[model samples]
Target chain A: MRVYHFSEQPYHGAWEADAPSLRVTLPNKHCDPKVAADLINWRLDEWQLCDELGLNIACNEHHSSATCLSASVNMPIAMMAGRTQRARIMASGYAIAQRPDPIRLAEEIAYIDVATRGRLDVGFVKGAPYEISPTNANPVKITERFWDANDLILKALTHQDGPFSWESEWYHFRQVNIWPRPYQQPRPSVFVTGGSPGTAKSSGANGHGFINILSGWNARTLFDMHRLASLEAGHGVTPWSKFVYTALMGVGETREEGHRRLMDIAGYFRTTSKVGEAFMNPPGYMDVAGNVRWLKANQTRGRAGNHFQAAKRDGEKLAIGSGVGTGLGVSAQDMADAAIAFCGTPDDVYEQMTEFISHAGGVGNFVIMAQGGEMPHHEACANLELFSKEVLPRLEEFDQSQIHADTEERVLSQRDEG
Target chain B: MQTATMTVDHVGIDVVRAGSGRPLVFLHSVGGVDRDGAFLQGLADRGSLTAPWHPGFGHSELPGEYRSVGDLALFYLDFLEQEGFEEVVLVGVSFGAWLAAEIAVRDAHRLAKLVMISPVGIKVGDRETRDIEDVFAMSQDELTEAAYAEPERRKRDYSTMSDEDLTALARSRESYAFFGWQPYMHNPTLRRWLHRIKQPVLVIGGTDDGLLRSGYLEGFVESLPNARLSRIANAGHYPEVEQPQAVLDLIDSFLEEE
Candidate 1:
């Protein structure tokens, strides 16, 4: 497994339980520029440490929020490209739907890929529902827009023959010719992250990597959908490398200490749920069926009133049950039981990971949120150091190729018999 | 009252019709419409009421190609032509009013008069401020409060509703978002074309409308060549629902004017 160290780069100092929200509604006056600068510099230093420690690096973007400082994902990737040498850098990812200019994004990614010397894995995401209003993007037809943008960006990156004219429902370009073409021949390895089967199917059909982040039991189902879609598209069974899983991770000298550290890191979830109900589920963000399900659930829970009451009710859920897939668990045991987090001594953490991998069929990339919430810089560095030294070698030794080959054989035999 | 599926341009449109006289087309707001509602009866009393649920609102089949208020307005124009209506009186509420304005702007020759109730289609505020409250952004209860002078009077118990009712509710929400999400509720360039509508217009607004500011109703009157403004007390966005008699009185007087 190729384990990638990731952090949301959260500004934990701004987290206040009484605050209306930590996201879109939170005013900029709460954000201290000097402290933000220090935090950004510290996080950068930690990413540099990952390079020396033999761990791959991953970056993600969020906007108009104190939860994540990385509003523009490209800036960090470009910054890391010049600093890190061997580690494969990934953005999981840029919000394609909200971005108005795909051609400009194409140029920026191309420059980053060239700078990284072809060591880049590009990831495109649909962004958070709460960000719809903040980005001033239409929530309707967002998925359609995302696909078009994705196609346009790829075309821009690969078409080196000459300028091309492109026009679609959501975007229009008179001429598309991006300079500094990607260093990778065909294009850089692409990854897409989402929680829905439709998204997984699209990712697979497009022959792109799929990342399932803390989706719990549903992660395997989403991966299988991706595999089936790829096969149906006549692309052959997708390899283990095409599937990635993300979770909060922590390690320490003892099992109890590791659990404690991970619990601390999981504080990220506590702050994340502070979003107001008004922005929780914007219309058209979720599909019709999904909205119906959510509405029914809320009504059943007697939380289907005004915004404040609904937000409070959801906050209660976040403290307990809703944390199953997300890292909002009240206890270390809750997180570990859900398999959305791995924490303990090297041996314990390794065993938990292998168990999860077995349950998931196979996952080649493990995206680890090493630093989250109020984790001090020194603590984050120590966690990374221990994980790299003790667990990385064992994880590298575990081969997915044999497992995948066996599964393929079993499937073929079953098909023949049927 | 009768609900029939009328095919226009190969698309199914659910039209509710009642009474008979000079054709009065009733366009509903984002909340869809109640075919059996008392307000619709008041409209029937006024003239031959022909209320068709906008495509994608209720049982109407939403054409994939139709994306904006302009498209819906054009479809409505076709509906009027297909039905062979003359001296048409166009009456619309809320989002439907926006459609009516667009229709009048396009072609006012067939329309004798226009009535817009609690309309939201034009931007009257500065760049940073929005003229209409974002229905998608607010909570259901918040929206209820904004849409009704007495919020409790408009409360709906979805749990008690039938499966079809619930599905219709969800579909209406989805359709509303699809049409109004971008550029919000107003067409930025629409204000420029208001002069094209020469038909006498009566713009009705709720005095207590939380969705619209005071000046928004006045702005519509000022833009139209032959138009006037009236307000209904004890009502919010849907004046006809809260104070039907008052709104109907104003409509009756306007229609009777020589």
Candidate 2:
């Protein structure tokens, strides 16, 4: 398994501000440019460390939000490609649906592919719900828009003959041609992030890799759905390597030290859930049936309410559907139990990761969020150095064939249930 | 009021009608007007009244091609032409009023008069100013307080509602967001064509509509050639529901004017 080092490059200095939300509505006046510069540089240094450690690097984008300072996914990828020599860079990824100009995005991707010397792994996401207001994007049928944008982007990347006109329900281009087509022949491997079975199945059917972030047990069903859909679409058996799972990880000399260090990084989950309820689920972000289910759960079982509040309450395990490592009161034990965070000494973290991969029926690429929230730069570097020295090398020795029988059985059982 | 499905332009629309005479078509707001509700009943008692759920609002079929309020206006015009209605008195509430204005501007030969209650269709303020509150950006409690004169009367307890009721409400909210999310609630250029709606219009505003800016109704009336502004007491965005009898009496008087 290949491990990718990741960070949200958060502006945690604003985490203490008296704002109703950390996203969208939160004014940027609270953000200090000098602090942001330092945070950006710190994360870049961490990505460079990954290069020396023989680990891959990943970055994601968000807008009008203090949670993630990387507003443009391409800028970081471009910078890292120039700065790091060996790390395979991935964007987890650009919100293709929210971006109005798919051609420009395609051009940038091509530029990055060439710059990275064919090391770019492109990922397309349907955007977060809070982004609806910032982007002024219509939430209804946004998934359809995502697929349409994906089609345009891929066509723009590979169509090298000449200028071409393209028109779709959401996008229109009079003359479409990207210069210096991708360095990778045809295209780089495409990945998509999704939490729903429908989205997973569609991703598989489209023959793209699937990435699930902190979804916990529900990720199994999502992965299974992707595998089954791929098989049904006549894509043959998809290797376990096509699936990726992202989680937070911290390593220290002692168990207590690791747990304490990780609790600081877990601030990402706490502050993210601090968003105003208005922006949490915009109308039409989910379909009528999905909204109804959410409403029912929210009203009756109190399941769909804010994780921030739930974590504040003493001793309530975060309701299902929550990404692991979420909420303010989540402990190190809770995170390890949920498989959202693997923290401890090198041996402990390695054991936890191996067990998680085995239980997941095998995840080929494990994206580790090494730094987030208020984690100090030195602490982050130390954590990475320890992980690289012990756990990462051992993890490389794991072979997927060992779990092939169990994964096949699980897939068949899931298919039979379906 | 009688409820039925009307298939227009190869799509189904949930329609409610009552009484009989010169057709008085009533277009509903975001939450949808009930067939047995006091507003429709009051309109029905006055004349033949027809209120149809805007596409995607309730049980209506929303054609994928339909994106904006303009598409809805066009569909309504086709429906009126197909139904062969004449001298129709068109009335609309909130979002529906936006559609009514669009339709009148496009073609008002079939429409004898127009009534717009808490209408939101035109840009009444400068670029930096917002004439209508961003309902999508407000919490449920905030929206409720903005939408009602007496917020408690309109506050909903979802636990008590049936699945079917919640589903319909969810669908209406989704449709509302789809139509009014971008460029907000007003069509930027609708103000330019208000003069094209030659039919006399009665622009109604509620005394307590927190959703609209102070002079929004007056500004809407000023853009028209023959339109007047009126206000219903103790009401908010949905004056037709909050003070149905007063709104009905105002419409009754306006329609009777020679």
Candidate 3:
């Protein structure tokens, strides 16, 4: 599997337990500028290391939050685009709905593609619920804006001349034109995260790649849908490997150490993750049906709300079980067991990941998140080194080609039978 | 309030009607309408009141092609024409005021008088500094604080709220965003078109509206050729909901003009 290294680039400093949300309500006192500077530099160094190691660099973006320090995902990508050669720059952000100007977005992506000489994978999302309001983007019209922006951006990139005037509900541009043409024909490859069937269909219809970060079994279902969509869009026998799978990964000297390290970080995240009802799902963020499904899926009904209640701004951290793991009712070990957390010795991680890839129907791109929450920088680096050296080369032979060939044969036979 | 269902432009919608006499249409704000408020009855007591839920809010059907605030104005204009109401008085609150102005600017021959309560369609200054309060950015408690002039009026026991009430509120905000999210609660070009309105306009606002501020309301009034401003004391965003008798008193003067 082609592995891409990713991190949320979490700020591990003091966080207020009583705050309504890390995104909107949390006071900025928790963010020390000096600490942020160090983290940004460290993250860049790590990404540069990934490039040297012949691994893909996946950069992420989030706004108005200390949960992730990378507010602008493109800055790092643009900076690295000129520097890095072999590694692909995955700008999995510039959130479609939240961005006010899609024309500027198209021009920016094209600039990046030129900088990277075409090694760019554009990642778009409707953005997390918290992101909607901070940008003052309405959740009700997010879908409309997303589709409109994507269509407009594509038009701007594909066509050479545009003083193209188009009117839509969300955007109106009298003269739509962008400079710094993309390195790739038409544009760089487009990838979108799929948490819902709607996104899967959009990805399929647009003939774009689908990435499932932690959907587990649902990833396979989405991949099948993507394949069907690709076919309907007249791109036949589309490689299922284009659908990438990501997991929270860590390697330890022993199994116990592995689980403990992951659990410690999981628990550290619990305080910031105690999202308020309104912040988590704002009014009108989703339609009636979507809201119901979201509420059900994220039922904090049994949450011991006061579990992490601490009098100080730096609240007393709770144990793993009584912490963030409780939000999903899954322990660190449960994550390992489910392949959501690939933590163990190098050999153990390799075995678990092979099983993960096999279970995912053998996706080509296996994205590994080595750093998250409060994991120590040195330990995370060590884990990555071990993973690349000991585990990376071993999985090259594990093949999904047989399954793909068989599926292709089945589809052809079905057509013949018809 | 009595709810009525009808089809306008082949779209189903639920319109709330109250009072009897002249066919005066009362358009609601972002919250749609207040149930336990006396404003509807007060309006009904003076004249026949008809308030159609804007397309996509409450039980109203949202047309697939429905895009801009202009569409809502056309939807109501067609509704008024289809219903055959002649010489109708237009009254609007907050977001509804913007829609009323949009319709009145397009065609004001059938419109007799216009009343805008804390209207929010004119940009008083650069949007960064003088834009309307972003209720979406506020936490629930923060939203409550910024919305009301009275302490008691600001509080609602959400724990005891019914599912229907909660759902309706959510739906209201969604539809509110439908027309208002882009231009961000005001039309940048709306101020230029105010002179086109042929009706005598009454611009009423609460002195303590923490959102748009009273000066912005006056700015809307100043734009119209035949508009006058009136301020209500000890009230907030929904002065009509807070103290209906005072708002009705203000409406009486404008309705009496013709």
Candidate 4:
């Protein structure tokens, strides 16, 4: 398996106990920049360590929220690309919908790929509902803007050594030209991440590398559907290497320590997350059924609600329909039940990850977000060390060689039948 | 009243046409078809009235090309010209008023007179001017509560609505976001072009609307050439629906002022 290290880069500093939320209401003065500056440097150093330890590193951009300090992933990713030598720097990635200029973004990504000497993977996400106010985006056009920018950016990137022009419902440019093309020929691999069937169909039909954040029957079903769509494109099928399975992971020297690490992730969630439905997801971001569920969750919210639904907040409600990340309130037990998170000794974590991979129908890229919430920098670093030493080696047995052979055999048999 | 399908630019729209005097075109607000209440029938009593659901709102097919309020304005102008309606007495309400103003500024030769009701266009102030509310962010109940003098009078409960009504409302909200999402509600540069509308105009609105403040009505009236203001008592955005007789009287008086 192609192992990668991922982190949302939480601030991990103290704030008001009952601040309502980590986003809009939380005062900016509460952010200790001196502490944050050190934290940012420390986080980068951790990524550098991961690179030295022989692993890929993935970082994401989030805005207007204290849950993640990565307001802009490009600058940090570019800086990290300059610092690291071996590890592939992937951004799970920039919110294309929030960006007004796709061409500027294209040039930035192209330059980063060059800086990395061809070790860049560009991934795009639709974004959280809270990203609306910061981006000055109309929540109604979020999906439209995302796809519009996606189409324009791809065409700009892979324009056959081009100076291309783009005109669409969202944007109109007279000329599209970039000074430096991508380091990787024909551009680096492009992937779009989403958890819904609609997103799955789109990513599959477009032949994009589909990375699922969840692993289970839903993931297996998504993979199968994607494979079928790719095949229907006459582009064969999505290669096993193109599928990424990302999960929250925590590991320690002892079982109790691992459990504490897991709960720390949950504790970080309970204190920081606000359970407001409209703030998390405004209207038009979801479908009719999604709105229904959003309403249902909003109705059931408060002290007397189910511990599972109330603790995790409405952030996880997005995950219920689409396969994005889990809500912070997700306990170690909840994570284990869904097989979306692992926290234990090396062997126990290894077994859990292997089982997750099996349920995913075998994926090539496996990203573990071991650092999140209030997990101390040293603690996060230690968890990574345990994971690298114990879990990383055992993952060698879960590669796609067998799946590739099986796929080849199936294609040949189908050809014979035809 | 008669209702039927009208095709414009290869897209089908449910159209309501009534009365048989002079042709007076009525462009509706973003509230969509259900806003076709007693006031509309009153307007039809005086003249030939033609009202179509805005494309993608209330049973109207969503054509991909109908992306902006500007597009809608251009389409209505084209419809009037194609149908050979001369000296059109045009009436626009809320979102539709913005469309009417767009058409008038671009080309006003065909319009004899124009009336705008609580229009949402022309940015008057950057900081002091209150913004149009984020209607798409609101629930159906919230929308109804803010839109009418008495929310219960409209009976716009989501639970009571038919599947068709609910779907149409959802689509209308989508259309609202598509047209007015970025600029919020008012057009940034439209204030400068208000002088281009040469037709005699009447700017009318309700006194008490949660969505619209007094500044919007004042700003709109002050910017226009050959314009006058008429306010309805104890009404919100849909003054015509809330106080139909008062609004009807104002329209009748405007028409008589030849």
Candidate 5:
């Protein structure tokens, strides 16, 4: 099984005047940038530690936010390209539409792809309004701009003629040819981030892939849509290979440790301001706006007379109470019973992931949010080590036989039902 | 109160007067009110003050077609001449600073002194300028962090605020865009016209300003023939709020010298 670890540099410490160190308020500790950088370097080192560990690691883009330091995704991608010779570099997605000139994005992506020798997975996105709006560009036009830019970029990358000519309402280009064609034939594997069916359909039709970040009931709905879209597109239906990626936050040496990690991350979300909530939770997608409206509509139905209570009944199930309970050292099964929560030791995480695979038919790829929400650097490193050593082995075994068999069985069942 | 009558695009221009002594006109910033005339009141407390809200701002009725900062300045100049307030002291902040500078450039004889705080007009290549995109992307805390020296104090508890209050805040902030839009902070011609403005000018800068760095203030002061720079430490883009006493002291000393 191919495993990709996602690292989000959670700003977990207080600003130090004397040194570049963050004094974390909770779990009460000092996390220096040096320590954080070491943790990152070690994570990269582990790739060489195992033959099964693919060179592919993921980083993201953000700006002037406390949570992450990689405001420019290119910085990390460039670093990874320079360091690794074999593994693929996947920027989970960059906010390409934010730039006025798409050519800059095309040039950078092509450069990285060429340097990496074809091992590149480019994930495209419109990005959050918090990032897009500040650039004087309308957030409402993000989807349109992304598609237009992508079309131009793809044409520019693959075309060999003296130049390319294209005209769109938003963008017009004459003689657009990007130099140093990618090492990968045609281009790098393109993926789009979305949590809804419409996004899945578009990705499938465009010959691109979909990386889903939804969980619980929504995951089931999204996966089903992706499968149908693949089938309808006449791209032979295979439950395991169809473009689908699932993300989960993992931690723990024991099942208890895993539960605690999940809780710790969840607590981070609860207290943080919803200031950039527009970025994390965009409207219209997953009926987010409708959920907000529903909560407002049913304010009287709440027991505690708070927005949270109203939200529980109307909005997508937020993992607040379960996260708190799990962090407090609650039993895994007990925490699981509280809600459709995902947390536990490496083994527990593997089992839960497998269950999700079964529910969605069969899993093809797993992307773990290995670092998130004020998770300390050392703790993140330890979690990665535990996961690599303990969980990956079991997952690799499942990939060998059970996962394939499960996929076959699921297809057969569907055929029989039809 | 002395009032002036000047017609621009068939609309009446009212210049209200308060206090009495040295003639000084108060130019309201992008979102400020002319009726309340806080700047004029403050100026009037010291001496004579004339306040007028630019067209399309506050209660001012928009003329048939008002365009460009220059048109607004011309209209203000006519009002000043009609009111017989020659060689008057002009005070402006933000976008108002742009209009005041524009007016001074057109006729330096009309303005004896000028004070521009966190002004917007000239573009300096060395400094990283904040565009509309940068402003909108900032969180309330981020915006306040960039705009004020003591951001923690200005950070409001919106949780307890009523929806009406939230709506009002949003509306007020949006209205600020009316004056600051178009070519954004730079007018291209503003820098070239700076040397033409012979009036004694004081440029106030906030050291901690994230939008425009202190280096920008130096460039601004250097552009003007008769200009001096005064900085407020531990202050952001809006030093008037963060270091009000410092701003007051600097203004007082500068005015006394003039």
Candidate 6:
């Protein structure tokens, strides 16, 4: 499996003049396009560094709050065009349906693809309720918008000369001729965010990739659902390459250290619940009615609010959380040990990652969460260095042979069965 | 009546007292309010008004140590208790509204009636939430266009302002660091604690607010036990500026009711 390092630059420091940090905090709203640009540059620099270190792709997300400065994924895609040639620029997603003109999105993607020389992995999303409000698009229609926009973007980017007319409940367009076609012939590889059965089905039917933000354990079920969807959609046992991608944070000197780091990140989210919620859950963005309806409908499912929350809880309980705190839950070493979970001696992390990868069905691309919460720059750089030295080389070697064999076997078996 | 320009915790907070009645405290929003700022004027025109600069806004000495919204809330609570305002009405607008909600949750008995206008704490679904990061990216013209309804009113040249006035605005934005440094302009659990507010709350939101939608007001009303909602038409996020009379009327109606 190809390991792609994902760095989310969460700019952390005191908001006041007295606060000290490498980056200066400009006096502006978090959602301003300029701040988004600055953050994109910072993250791209990190990504470029990772590419130099032999990582596959650099990743970031679009969100309104503190967790992410890039509210619109398009900005990063545009910015990363000239930065790096080798590493794929992954816009984890832009809430495609949220924009008024999907055609404009098509044009932008085409422009970026041409500029980047075919190194773009586009992630389409329906967007969380919080991020959706800024677009002024109806929340309920977001799913429909995503599908329509995806179809249009794909058609516009791939098809050469013909009037492309689309008639849908939400969108209506005729004679769509997108200028400056993408560098990749069939358009850049498409990846959809979310782990729902519906998303899996859409990914499979469309012959795109599926990215699951869930924990490793729940990821199995997601992959299973994707496969089932592919089978149902007549794809018939497709290779894992076109199926599943998992995003996670890794750090370790030993197995224990890796677990501790994951826990610390989780703990940061847990203790700073208000901060996370404030950053993640902006007002008038998500479908409050839908969320309330879903909660009421699935109240029997216990405390799980939605799929995202469910995955987080499951991931935290199984690996993410357990890695941070020890059995007793209250100990200085335990808290201190948490840092080691995400930041440790390199060899130990490789082992922890290998075990996670194996359990996670040997994921195609392991998107490493390089930045989160208030993790310092030096710490992030240190983690990256250790990961490169200790873990990446081993993974690269294993992937070269393991992935090739797995693909060959799977393909041969499918052909024989057919 | 006594007026003192004392520094509390190195924060030059102004204290205003009038009449032998119940103590009412007011926390102004971003820009410093003069006698014309209806909310401050209305309260002072009615009863005792203890209007403080909130460390970074008005004539107050900006505290070097303050950071994070919780710190501001805690400081205000301490400010009230220190000033011997046993029972008080806490009125906050915009950022101050969030502070008011937080204060009520933290210590409800100290507050009599909590008033928040265009308060932002909970995530309101389907409204255009202003991206603080994005706002910072704009030029002064763009900032004014985004922030105020009357863009013409914003001074073309801030350079012309007196050193003190300029410093105050800068300091206010800097103090904004305490409340809005990280995660932009929100405290996640503040919404969770809305239910904890025992005191009556009057939430006023602009009907035409592009930033925050009407549903936010409804959510606020639903969340708080003794909360009422009032919508101001033709008003943006800052209704106190856009529809001052309507806001004052709502406050009057809310306070007059049993």
TM-score, chain A, per candidate? 0.91, 0.92, 0.86, 0.86, 0.75, 0.75
| Model 1 Cα lDDT, one tens digit per residue, A198-313 | 88999999999998777765677787778777777777777888888988898999988888789778877666656656776776777766666665544411121121111121
lDDT of each: 0.82, 0.84, 0.73, 0.73, 0.61, 0.60
Question: A198-281 in candidate 3: lDDT tens per residue?
Answer: 887778778878777665545666676676667667877457567777777777778776665666555334644554445565
- All candidates: DockQ: 0.51, 0.60, 0.29, 0.30, 0.04, 0.01
Candidate 3, residue A354: lDDT: 76
- After TM-score superposition, the amount by which residue B24's alpha carbon in candidate 3 deviates from its true location, in angstroms, is 0.9
Report the lDDT tens digits of candidate 5 across residue range A1-418: 5666765555545322232111111222344677667655654454333223442577677554444556677877787777777666677777767777777778788889888888678887766434543355544335667788888888777787767778885577786778788778788878877665677766666766667753444555565566555655666444464444645455587777886666555433332222332233222221323333433433211111111210111343343322112233334343343323456777677777677666666666666666566566567666677777777778766752465466555544564566
The predicted structure with the larger DockQ, 1 or 2, is: 2
Instruction: Give the per-residue lDDT digits (tens) of candidate 6, residues A81-137.
Output: 676777777767667787878888888888888888888878887765445435545
Give lDDT tens digits, candidate 1, residues B177-229: 78888788889988899999998999999888999976888989999999999
Which of the two, 2 or 3, has more DockQ?
A: 2
Candidate 2 residue lDDT tens string, A3-112: 89899899888877787678887889999999899999999999999999888999998888888998888878899999988789999878988888899999999999
Instruction: Give the TM-score ranking, best first.
Output: 2, 1, 4, 3, 5, 6
Give the alpha carbon lDDT tens digit for every residue of A1-418 in model 4: 6788877777656434355456655677778899889878878888988987777898887765666788888867987888899999887867898888899999998999888889999888887666776777777767778888988888877776556566677888877887677889888898777666777777777888887774444676677667666776765767877788777788888877887776665443443344333355555666544544433434211111111221121223322221112354345755655666677888778888776656555677877777776777888788888888888877876566666667545644554565
Q: How should the candidates be ordered by lDDT, best one leading?
A: 2, 1, 3, 4, 5, 6
By descending DockQ, how would the candidates be arranged? 2, 1, 4, 3, 5, 6
Model 2 TM-score, 2 decimals: 0.95
Model 4 scores a TM of: 0.88
How close is each model in CA RMSD to the real structure?
Answer: 3.6, 2.8, 5.7, 4.5, 10.5, 19.7
Better of 1 and 3 by lDDT: 1
TM-score of candidate 4's A chain against the true A chain? 0.86
Model 4 Cα lDDT, one tens digit per residue, B81-131: 876788888888898899899989888888989989888877766676555
Tell the DockQ for candidate 5. Answer: 0.04
The local lDDT score (0 to 100) that residue A275 gets in candidate 4 is 30
Least accurate stretch of 10 residues (summed lDDT) in model 6 chain A?
Answer: A298-307
What CAPRI grade goes to candidate 1? medium
